[model samples]
Target: MHDLIVSPFLDGFLAVRPGSPACVRLPTDLYEEVRAGADNTVPAWLVQTAADAWSLDLDGKAARSALLVREPTELAFARASWEINLYCNFGCKHCYLGERPLAGLSWDDKVKLIDIFRDSGVLWLQITGGEPTVDPDFEGAYRYAYRQGMMLTVSTNASRLWKPDLLRLFRDCPPYRVVVSMYGATEESFDELTQRKGAWKNFRKLMAAARNAALPLRVSIVVTDDNAHEVDAMKAVVQGWGLDHHVYTNMQPTFSGEGDPLLVQSTEFLRKRPVFEGCNAGVTFFHADPHAKVSICKIGRDDQIDLMTEGIDGLRRLGEISDRLMLRTGGCTGCSLSGSCRVCRPLAKVYQEAKAPLGMYCQHGDTKEMVHP
Candidate 1:
């Protein structure tokens, strides 16, 4: 049977034989319809293809392996993300970690953190930061995780991926993938958004070095109003470079409690999405911030407790707290739009109130239209 991999947010998917190089990134519309399943609008051939590969009946009624939702906390948490620190060398105007005193778990503390994740049954680790490359202890941390047999997924700006120390270390202990965030298409637009001179040059340098070494690299372009004009150009450039990439439009609230959607894309550009229903966060997947605060996800930071103080049972204890905080208030519960509403408690906190539909609702009237990958 073939294995299907679908991203809930990125609007892309890959279907491949689990251990072989046989894979295809399905077209967006086909992926969406297959993900939609019963309520799919596509022709029967597409659904039939998906079912045959995933070993489902021709009707496509059976849940796709990629779409199956796993429940439970500690016992099932094989995927987790660790925000090493919110420190970065470059200044991006749209950063959620906005200008804060750099604070993070020390080397020993981080090692302990890694152990905690492993003990909690984590098998896939996501290493992210304001820029993970900026951390001195990153190599040690990465090595420790690697030795534990956890598949690593790193997020970086590609600024220091070319360093002899890092290149050698990662070359020896390679991650499953490394994602580089692209700010803009041109040097001028790059500097305009990132506010760093010569950063464009540095990025190119790292790119060249990485290409020469043949590193497993992918690109993620943060779609924003400022760089909207260059989105096509950026995608073209990355594609021309023989890179696989995806574009994300959401600009979340700042880490400083500033509910500013500063870098949000224009309404015309953002794909209309249905209100989010369930998430993998906290249940099967989780997030650990720089200060050891464990939360459901990045946007769910405010709803989290301190991991160091709360211990491994942090999420278990936070159940009641989440229940209480998730109670619908204001016009949301009473409004007819509540059922179709895509805004959840975590994202709701980003605005002045929980009520949404600010034209952000899904294009299709039903929740089935929601694209996972």
Candidate 2:
């Protein structure tokens, strides 16, 4: 049978189209007889491989098969997301944390955790937070991780980007990328969203600092109903500055079930049931909260496993949960949502308790379909 290995680095398996046919997972050692695909459009490393014949016999293999591989496969992770600190000075209207950063792993513990990711073969690391700069040891943590050979991505508000220490750090060791989230296009709208006056002026200064330092930068405008009218203006302003930018309309859900009324996308724009083959969340990507709980993905936080201990083995275990969830389940059994739920898992507690969509999960789109408890 013709097959192609989708991700050799993790959960190595054949790539198949949505509802293509039945497929099975195999051990790495059993993978044999690989030939490269001739198509230049495909990844050169994605080789075409064939499966071995079924052997029902007990004394199955030869001594030569045992020595084919000289060593056990190395643990490899392509990317990671770290919530370094959940504390932010600004009270964003759409923040998911919805709380002042009260507690988390200490600075030294954070450094050790960075080492763990490095040792486990994570090449790209994203350091995020309620705002990463809020952490006391932000500079130290940033420098330590970059020195370990990780290409880092930092998401911040630009509030602390120009601090003497951070500016020095950036000049010495530039990050792979920096993303600043602009809540609005003008001072009034920006101040309204962050509830902090003079924030837009600070944002402009941050841009000036970024330009002066020649740091790689990308800006994203969070388009909400409150600032929907400014979407085109924001895009034009950001592009006019000669830097890359994008816009997102989705709103974050707070753990307390207090979702923002003004940020939900319209039904016409709501994502409906679309065909998807599969996702690489726990398999290829992982998100760790400030407390060090590693979840399969951002939306699957409540059911996450602890990564404070067991380290790599703990991360590897996440794949099993992801694999199981990717299969059909009750209510989804033979239902249309089954094929479409490639990476989807259960939504937060409010949805389960209410049996309805919450926030962006609200495919029903309008307020009429969403019942407020």
Candidate with top lDDT is 1
lDDT tens string, model 2, 1-373?
A: 1122222334453322111222334445343322222222232122221222221121322323211111213566667899888898788786766576657888777877887777656656789988988888788888887666566788998888777778788777667788889888899888888889998899888888877887778898877655667878888888988889977665546655555533444333333434455678777678888878887766666457776776657777777877765554433446544444423543423343343453344333344455444
lDDT, candidate 2, at 195:
82
Indicate the residue-level lDDT of 358 in model 2. 37
User: lDDT of each prediction vs. the true structure?
Assistant: 0.66, 0.62
TM-score: model 1 vs. ground truth: 0.73
Q: Tens-digit lDDT track for model 1 on 1-373?
A: 1123332222334443221223456666655565566343334664566566655343443444323211122344657898897888878776877674567888888887887777666656899998887877888999887765466788998889779988887677666788899988878878777889877888888988887777778999877776888889999988988989988776655655453454355555676556567566666667888877887777666567787776777756544554554555532446566666666756655543322334443223444332221
- Model 2 off-target regions past 4 Å? 1-73, 261-276, 325-334, 341-343, 346-373
Clash pairs detected, candidate 2: none
Estimate the lDDT of model 1.
0.66
- Per-prediction TM-score, please? 0.73, 0.73
